[model samples]
Target: MATSGGVDVGAAVIDCGSFLIRGGLAGEDSPRALVPSAIGTRSGKNDVLGHSLWGLPELVDQVVDVYDPMAGLQAIPKWDVMKKVVDHVLSKHLMVSSKETPLILVEPSYMWGVNGRAAAAELVFEGMGLKSFFIARGPVMAAFSAGRSTSLVVDVGHQGAFATAVFEGYALEKSKQTSVLGGRALSDYTYQVANEKAGQNGIRARYELPSMSGATTEKESKAEGSNGVVDSTAAVSKDTAGSEEKEKPKDGSQDVEMEVKEEAVPAAPPGEVSKVKPTTVEAPPPAPGAVVPKEGVAKTFSLDSKKAFYRMQIVHDLKQSALSIREIIETPDPEANGGGPAQTATAAAVVAGSKVKREPRPTVYTLPDGTELDMGQEICERIPESLFDPRLLSDSKIPGIESARSLHRLAYEAASACDIDVRRELFGGLVLSGGCSLFPGVAERFQREVAAITPQMFKLRMVSPSLRQDRASAPWVGGSILGSLGTFQQMWMSKQEYDEHGAMGINRKCP
Candidate 1:
């Protein structure tokens, strides 16, 4: 997604999850192009309510050399944390940017309240003394990134993953878009496993802190266990005052205390009973299974220990189910058993239009609390015959698959309407742009199964964007590039035009 001018276009895109806010300036094609879309900040300043106290702040050593600070951000009230992230990017990027430009802010569809995302984008730019334009439709931006005449764009983010079809440069309004329980769900899952591992080791319960590191950072540190010295750059956390938490060795053995903590795990008062109950809630207890690599002890993330982190591995693979569930539950049909989901053209619309999805069936994972984390059929997958056309989920009784199929049915039907068009002309390339595209077999699955659920009239060929790394940003970057066209003004409504015509009128003006 290249821009038109001799004048460089500078913009920052932010993903504000409940736990973390990721801000990244558009970068050139490179290995780690998007840089994990994360930011890190101190305990008090990063959060407004100080909820961050629930989680440990990045260690001083972690901060000074942290390539991307947000990676350490714990799962907290994401919008607030995200705002801080936006402010951080504004300040940090502004120091090096030209204020003479408009900073385009691409936001998630569910940002703040209704219409709040656009306003937030406006405010972010205005506060920075830069004119602002909002790119709220992530799927549309991704479609723009596709730059093809016709294609499908699937965007999987940390918090959500969705799919959209683009035809003639615009998203297909009626296409089925899915919102799978995303990275946050994965974090929650990992948190559970870490806790379970801890409890299994007889470490009594305490509050668990939200934790994750973009593999870019944590993976390197995990690998460096081969080195003689502990990577001093790893983030540090403080345990409760009483517990004398020992270092977890890589070989699953406790050889010695290689690292030192300033604060000892405090012990309870003499004969005082511990309030931290082993049985409390379905969620995992903090640090339950977390292997705190002692500063000096060599370490490796154990395979058994790594299952908690399954969310990241499957983010790209199983996210369609999540989105499908969000779509169905959000459908407008009053008779649906559940409370209706958010109402938008996206009605699970990842791209141009919207979709209908049943409430996701709970994905049941054995949680520490003698309970199972119910992620639903939408979230859990077991080598389905067709990832696109899942039989178990499509039960007419179960709203999750029923409704998801409903969305696909609608999109496929519409696609059938365009049967006369050649797929070679329609989807010259299948563009897979999203965090989930990072998953293995996504392309194969789509080609094999997506058509099964659709009408048989059309032949499908798959195409995807070349830039797979910073996929979350690919669509926005692509749209930004197209928007650079001199003729684009013909389709754009001026602020004055929008003001003159009310919302209805503005809708008429939209490109």
Candidate 2:
């Protein structure tokens, strides 16, 4: 509800990612709604909307096709379905008429040539019948959120990661780089690890259905938790101890995989695994007359597409709650006495050996059904480590896993691709944004890793917001600040302008 020129500037900011869509009024500190960028549909029925599309027990009961419209921050494939999602957010969540409210939409920097910007402009100006609209790139807005007009913005989002060089509020088109190592990739890796451990330790995973009598209201479901989905840890439990054998899916389609195409990058030498003995959590011995589940019991259940989607959500929760970047500190080699060249080689080996001995403490995470997953330090640490070393994913079947570069490499390459005059500024002002970057120690680790490859003359600094919400919704917050400024009123592309020059005209006005 900000005002410009004494007129109410009721502009709304919508920043959509592969996993979530953040929306709110201008001038707000945080987003008012964070809906899933997905929709559910059944033949001859109304489309299921918002959090309900997550296949929550109280929201959806039957099998349905859950389509994610914004996957990998790419161009919209199903414009018809995407239109419904936008309409729902405006009318249901924001509670404003599309015709009256001006809009600022945030897109990825690489989306321009693919007609993503033009299509979005069409959707807002023609499809939604909005009075005014503007399109902003994700990395540029992320820089603005950190109070920097020029910075190297590394956005680690749900589907993919991007490093873009922004100079004076303009993103360098050639300097933008992308990778498949992101939140979803980490979640998939976590899921794979959990499945392997479940097979070995008699653990099980199943969907816990809510009771009809205790179902939450629609309004309650919408506000149940952040990111639209209800809290998975607090979900109802119906699983019990029982004997069952492991069952594998017939088609292997149940395995979680990223939607992007696969590409290959040269693999790095594998690191040595730690030899430290780790403790494992075991279930208590069954009481008299109690049935004890046998070891290696999978208790596999048939999951429809909808249920598979929900299972992925559970894995995502585990990644967010349990996974963290393992801080790697280089230690001086003790064997490096003033000696022959062979001694220096031996010293380097000793340093590498020391890294294998530092293991993180194990953490136990309880599932919705009260099943405890005792994640060993190696697994907990390695999951986030994959972001920094894509070679860790070399064993997995995910497409493009072999081709993905570590985040630091991506940042260095992007900045190097920029003009020589601005490379120093880009390196000095590195901004971390996106939900995946919220992992503890990410900022410190990124800055340290990037500095190792950077020129000695340039000083590097990491700009990360202290609040978790601020980093996760950085792009939306930036748009909110820009939309509410009185001096920025003339920047909006009005309806008349769209009619005069068509959707492509938005590129000139917004840029």
Candidate 3:
């Protein structure tokens, strides 16, 4: 956690996720800071301060297991790390007086089990010395962020994606479900596409660089080199210094030609030579998959040139691919629906029929060492479509359970499991909230898919956070809003109550 220069006595809210942890003072509209949800072990690197480091860019390239505090359906898997994470969030990021102020912890709906809830309570009140606390589900927080009491929250996170139905601030547990696919899966797919392309083009295949920064086009670097930016002073220096210069041509026709002859200076005695100024030329950029050192410490780091393409272009393609594949799956086919000999054939045809509509969008990315990588329409638009269409997945050997669920199916199942009376309300209150939901067309596409399954008579109203950037941290915003309210004060489990009832009291107090 990185501390900002401010202190607030009010309760602080933390929205924890697999990829990022968003937190701030309770009364703020949005979180004060967002950090990667990873903790780094003690290493010799300057980036890893003391025993652990959180959300620093240098730690990403470090040789340590980046520990994710939350995994699978369980929240706060590593108890010690979770304690440190909470302490860091409250004391550093939020800059709050933990022992004096209250705390609001946001978590996934699936993690509301008795054990996880009690452990979180113990960690907050007992472990971190926080005085008061309240545990809120991510979906419920998302609903509150949207200013709605009832909603079906779809969170596309790093570990997995979930669709949870919340009615009047309470989660409908039966209908809450998650799939294996999420932001991490998409990043993996991007890596796969880049590696495959590299192999096909005979380039050394490697993972995409997570970050890089300098030339925007491939031609620009070549042009700079050809224009004599490299060693341009050599020719002029030959004439100026005590060295040989070329003779002028006879056909110059009144042109002044100055040609200097070479002169060797006498060698100096032992240790008598003066050191010439060191050249300040920039070193050539390393190749796509090569290690280079910084600060001349001899500790080198590998660079993956493919990162620019993945971050700028491949991610957008993934969003487009998800939208396209989802539309195909949800669109019903009459022949595939019927039971006949041709039914199987029709279903196969329909599954294979849909194609990604490609538009010409060229992208140019600059590498940190001033090199550029150019991507064409095909390369820029290509992503693993199989995530949404399992048939498109090349590996048939994968177990059915592991590679099965699609986005459309997950949404349908969640909506179907809701009570019949409020099923319409659930459909209409569908809220897309998460890092992945920040993709341009995801919300519109999600609304369209839900509208397809819903009857025309009931209005299908889907909404997202008002600010585009807030979509990723919607739950944090909700926690901030909820914790600030005067009515919410009664919900916090104070230190006095925790002392009397112990950690188990959280299940009853928060409930």
By TM-score, the best candidate is 2
TM-score of each: 0.49, 0.74, 0.65
The regions of model 2 sitting more than 4 angstroms off are: 1-9, 54-56, 109-114, 200-303, 328-362
RMSD of each: 16.4, 13.1, 18.1
Instruction: Name model 3 segments beyond 4 Å from true.
Output: 1-8, 44-63, 73-76, 199-390, 393-403
TM-score of 1: 0.49
Instruction: Assess candidate 3 and give its TM-score to the true structure.
Output: 0.65
* Candidate 1: residue 89 Cα off by (Å): 2.3
* Cα distance off (Å), candidate 3, residue 438: 1.7
**What's the true lDDT of residue 391 in model 2?**
87
Query: Once model 2 is optimally superposed onto the true structure by TM-score, how far is the C-alpha of residue 453 displaced, in angstroms?
Result: 0.6
**Local accuracy of candidate 1 as per-residue lDDT tens digits, 301-385:** 3322222222222221222222222221222343221322212222221112233343443344333234333444433443222
Weakest 10 consecutive residues of candidate 2 by summed lDDT: 245-254
